[model samples]
Target: MDMQDIENKYNKLIIRIPVFLGLALALGIGIGFMISIPRKNTVSEQSSKITEVLSLIQNNYVDSLGLDSTANFAIQKMLQNLDPHSSYFPSDDAPLAKSQLETDFEGVGIEYEWVKDTLFVLYPAKNGPADKAGVLAGDKVIAINNENLAANTTQNTLFKKLRGKKGTSVELTILRGKNIQKISVIRDKIRSYSVYAYAINSEIGFIKVSKFAEKTDLEFTEALKKLVEKDKVKKIIIDLRDNGGGFMDRATKIADEFLEAGNMIVYTKGKHKRYDQEYLATKGGIFEKGDVVLLIDEGSASASEILAGALQDNDRAILIGRRSYGKGLVQVPFELSDGAEMRLTVSKYYSPSGRCIQRDYKNGKPYDKNLVERYKNGELLHEDSIHYDSKQVFKTKKGKKVYGGGGISPDYFIPLDTTDLSTSILNLMRENKLREHASLFAKNNKKILIEMGLDKFDKGWQIEINTFRNIVGNISMNTTQSDYLKLYYKSYLAKVLWGNEAQIQIRNTQDKAVLKALEVLK
Candidate 1:
């Protein structure tokens, strides 16, 4: 009952591994093509035959690859023929994959970055595990649970080693300056806020929503209320830069706040009539009549496109920036028998003016890399590089022409600015030397920096060019590079404390879109 039984079980597992691998491999094909209820007879028959073949292969395949791995590989390859957003999440990875939308993670809270193959502590979440255990900036994370992560480690590997269920503990070996110390960290649930910027000034307000997550609409509405209802600002700027959207309902809610009742916020269509739906502003909007400026960029996608397209098509707000990321496919989730989750494209979203903001994926896989092609074609640097067909054009409520071949072309296109940036400057930023310097400055001048606040610090406080040159360590900086460094330092310095809203609000002074928007507003 001992060795013989174990050997038999192992042999069975090895023989049946192919099915697991095939199921995993084919997982991606199920994403974006999910049917909640059940498939038709023909579809059912097709699935049965596929399963039978996989079973046969599992029992007789010469190689004994694990079932799950083989299935995952097959699914991944299959998805290449579909849209980019549809994806498969293996059972072990499903939970963590949903962390961003969940807006929290079970882990010892800390912001971290890997530089030159070594993990560096950016800052610990206040009162979180690392902070509570005396982790410090400039400290090198050498090992986790004495596994020695120093020589070779990826961000993914390090993150997995650190995160677990709440109240679980992990040991860390840290090298701070000269001394090496071992610390025990207890992991806990850490909440991540999506709203990165908000402020009211000059009879105008600004808010930057980084992503559309679970509470994004709540955050956006609260931020707008703070600006309009509380501060009574005449105009507002909603910055949706780098927002790779989340829930469609959440985006609809956010768009609803800015649109008048009866306005079409967005709509979606699928093969089945049930998947077809429309969202409209059901009530009077909060800032319905206010002069609004929406800032979007190449990174703005999904629900981001919905809100921006709604506002733009309604002629409610002026879009200021480069074209948004065109991702209009709607995904529905299904759980596999093995507990893995799949997101399949069930529908396609359309902006109010009837523009499908999905970029053409017919060319091939890696549709997301269209941005790179756009850059190569100088689309980022010039609007002339963007070829919009007349058939794809639509008129706003105010008769303003908007193109929708893919992505929203802003009313005001702000070209990418790489001027005054050099290798030296990039190196400084890459190393986060300014962030490191700012951390030290914040510690040493915590009283003064905080007392001064970001506004005062930006305008009045003088950290000086020499301070940057000294901390950055003899790096040759031209005048442009030096000036850029000063602003970079100022931006980091503006963030006297991590999570301070003042940083973005203050740094907008240097934003091209903000400046252009101000011109239009004036």
Candidate 2:
């Protein structure tokens, strides 16, 4: 062939060869698709699939579904898969959730308990809306805003009804003995103090911190001031037994009060460097010179752990009770575009000894059932049952060994007391008979009890065994159980008449952990 004829043939052959190879490649792909199993979805694909499914449901579903609700639920489920702590709060629930850690909220401000579908006023908060409206303790709430509370009326429903925007009014029909009185209570801002402090004796002061909130450090400082200045308390017991924690800064601030200057309180490390930071104690700590003891348990978590870990690692305080709730994860709240809020776990915190106290959540293990597992493994009752990670050990400032990969173990372990937890006692507690009995006793002798006061009642009053038997109805109990029942009755009575502080004071007379704390302080 000539040069031109050869060039034209080569170009035509190249085009034909590609066409043939493309056909063969298409055939091979079709055969492979027919025989191959489906592979797992990629991260991006799975996420897109979720959005597509949600869109499809919104546009084409048979029934009308709330888009916000659906999206909120999906977000909640997604967060659940990430960790136990990360959570999504809907717009309606966000305020209430945040209010738990707020210093105050607008409400009628009466602590109540439901007895036999009847809402009983435990006590109206001093100078609060209900108190200003002359709502008395022992009053039964018959109705709210003319809506009679039925058997189906839940506590949450009642709470919503009682709480409203500032300057709003809630009309309550209260049954105070035989008199049914209609009272109009104007809801106003009520202070919800997180710290309850009182001198247990001449030398020992007890402070119970329910949670870390916006004003927690201020409240704690005031508490310490009173204990040290007015009460002349040389030792203090910080009771953080069931505090679930709140603001990290509040906890670190309280830790600073106990720790000396320049001491590292806690440090956080995250994927992003911005979330990584260290909290150190500053100068002029109020209670730096006192003998300090902290009481913690499985319910004590997050900020509670932070404070306890700081004190224990520095040997500044003795921790007494069960191991703390193992949560070292630091969550930061982010507001979504739809006004919803999400608390995402951003970092893990460590103590001064460089130990992260977060327990293992690997292999899809049941993390929520950890406390139950601890109970099952006899860890709560026996110190020997605790399985510490051998390789995760760290030392305190005093060279004492502490372990990570779990929680902050106390220097002294107080076993969970099941001594007074008899079947009869349990039944009484479950049936609310004990509280009912206490309520009735307080009501019948309200005048006498009020006149005599908590001190005299603590010193002289005793529930007769016959009276206890009559209230509980044919349940047999040992002397120990009976004594415990009496103690509880008195404590509940004290709570109804006085307040939580008085109740704690009464209960601390028999509280093993409190007793241990006092011993450590001494």
Candidate 3:
């Protein structure tokens, strides 16, 4: 196209080219938008279909159906498909679920055990409703509110009868020896402890954390203060075995107590940016300088794993016991319009070493029977049986090798103690014979136990072999098993006389995990 005459034509052609390109791009954009609309509509349509079906069933069904219950069940099933941890709680169960992690609850406040289908009071909470109404330990509860407790009556039924709104009263028919008495107890708020601390020795402290509740961090801080300042303990053993876990914040706060400032304890990532969070340790840690030995087992999950992972990744504590429960997902509770609750898994947390604690559940694995599977695979008895993801290996702050793909593995592995757990022992435990015997013994020696006191009783008390033989009957056991049974009976007697702390202390005298922790601390 050359020179002055072609230049004018070329300019016009270039201008037309720009308009042509704009039209082509617009057409492509329109097609893209058309393709994306169906994906959005598909989700909307599926949701509408569920609602339509529910409405149809509610309006035109032959028999009247509780739509509320149906909807709750449907929601629960849908959440189950998402993950094992996400769950839906009905209105009636919602409060009970939330109350588990609360510091206080309204009830008559008596810890009881079912022996041979009869409920026997282990002990009443001091100054609580049952205690104030003269509900003595070792008394048999025969009826509640005049409703006789049949042999088939479930403990849950009795639990419901005992728990009611604050300031309400319940009548309990108690049988003590040959006499039956009716006692009325007014329900009141009863305080609960998540943290239990005692001196393991003059220089070592033992703290058992049952769960990470709303007041867990505060309670732990108080226990830490008493151990460090009052008891002059330089070493601490934190027992997290059987702690199913509760609040993440509570666990992180406790972890912060042992971590230095500016350290990253854990971090979480999710689908939404708002759910992404990084937890860092703050200043003024209470037990930062002490030697810490953390004990965990298969029952420890969620917040317990977070605490263990933090301490392990930072190389701040020596972990002892079997591998913990693998639950790295973080759930956020949502209150429904009908007063129900939905706990939805929002995020997956990672330790400071960049290892995700969640196990493989999407690969056709049975998530609910994980512990059973672990036992079958011999992971509990042998540390070498544990399957580690070689691809998920990560390094701790101190350059220690740690693995992901599942729970936090302890530095020192202690196999599960199945010794002394014979068939006879199991049968005795199943029938609650030991507890029944202990209750009877405590009832007969109530005056003696009170007068002797816990300290003296702990020092000089022993369940006679003949007394144990009477409870055993024809059930045969070796010396070791017999000794273990006798020790457990003594512990139960301590429980009936004193409380849970006394029982724990007496049991710890020969507990394998506690002994291992002591060895590690030493």
Candidate 4:
């Protein structure tokens, strides 16, 4: 054939496909289509198929699967990848954790500590059921309701035994000064104080709250009355370091005492919203007009932010300390189908002046690393080193400029004091050697330590340096030490055994932030 005729024949052959051969190929394609998913479908269909495969394994696999736990764990992993603060508390942990942030819990009304295997009574709240029944400190718990305590019983186990619904009776067999006696006590609502008010030298009223709980407002009022009116306290120093956060309502209640009514305390909003919801100060305050100073540091967050923000904004209180840990998300608890709950961030909380004290949290980026970044940038060391992004500025009612998208900046930046810190102390603390040493010290000198009052122990006490040295000498490590480290360890051990307040007293002596706050009040 000629070249043109051959080309025409080739085109016709391609179209025909040998008739029967083409029919067989088409039949095979149709059969494959009947069994397999179409390639033209969206990617979602492929994901659904993979999910179904996993579900099958979870349901009818050879081994029984913990499907709920697996799913929650997966969710937790996903959230962790987002931010450190975005944590998932499972059903078992949620109640216990939530109680600490709230006002009260159902438990026997007594504070106790475990020394070795014995439980030592610390303090009983005044008018509390335990106190009414005459439970005192230094008393030891030997048994509960005639049941001999299991050998090496942990404090947590003891707590589980003691804590129950109100009106429930828990019998405690006590060992008091070599005398054993059994006492039946009624379980009641244990109200934890958010504000502890006392006078320092009859002049400065000290109110140190660990966090803002549900009953913080009422507690604050009672505390203020006891401190200011009853004790005749003049200036107030509110310490809020290491207080991560709690109820915002309680924060506003505390702030209202310092701020006049109608002042905007804080605001909140999200992406879909335009104008923010503002929380303002209402009527009725315990100390509507008083000289107040607030203490803050890197650990202060959320509700702590609200109180600090309001106090700072209203100029009613002088904020003295380092910058706070900015965490401005407001979380709401939602229960899953499995009784497990998730504290989902509902909105971004803003200070009264429209400053969102939440630092940037972008997807796939590190959030907790901000503190390290701040330290490297010298923000922890000096106020001058703090540079604000001009674009994220907000102004207080008084027109004082404040920055958003970060934590609340203290009016007075107190540099972190590492003067007393040493490699020896840090190592001991991290390794829990100090705790062990405290236990030993308590066992040996229980009576002698008890005789020494907290005040006397705090003032004249020196940690048994030789004992500490002997312990440290036994430790197999190469770490430098200082005179302060040796003495500090001794003091810390004494504090842990003698009383928890002892450590605070010792730490207060060297805490630059506390001193700075005191100076501001003065």
lDDT of 1: 0.73
Off by over 4 Å in 2: 1-49, 113-120, 134-143, 146-156, 173-183, 419-423
- Using TM-score as the measure, name the better of candidate 1 and candidate 2: 1
Q: Count the backbone clashes (under 3 Å) in each candidate.
A: 16, 0, 0, 0
Order by TM-score, highest first: 3, 1, 2, 4
lDDT of 4 by residue, 1-522 (tens): 132332332232222211111121111112222222236567678668757967987878898878767767877886666544455656765554455554578777776755555666655555677766756554677788787776588544675788799999888888766678888888888776666555665777777777666677788778888887888877788888867666666777788877788988877785434323577888877777878889998767777777888888777778888888777766544556566655545467677777778777774444545555565677878889988879998777777877877788888888865432334444554444544555456656768877887667767867665766666665433333444565466555555454434555566666676677678777
**Candidate maximizing lDDT:** 3
Give me the runs in candidate 1 sitting further than 4 Å from their true place.
1-41, 52-62, 150-156, 364-366, 419-421, 474-476, 496-498
lDDT of 1 at 198: 54
- Put down candidate 3 lDDT per residue, 408-487, tens digits, no spaces: 99999988776444556666776666776787787678898999998888889998878778888988777778778888
Q: Model 3's lDDT to the true fold?
A: 0.79
Whole-model lDDT values for every prediction: 0.73, 0.79, 0.79, 0.65
| Alpha-carbon deviation at 420 in model 3, angstroms | 6.4
What TM-score goes with each of the models?
A: 0.87, 0.85, 0.88, 0.70
Residue by residue across 244-322, what tens digits does model 1's lDDT show?
A: 6766677788888888889998888888886788888988678888899999988777778888999999999999999
> Where does the lowest 10-residue lDDT sum fall in candidate 1?
16-25
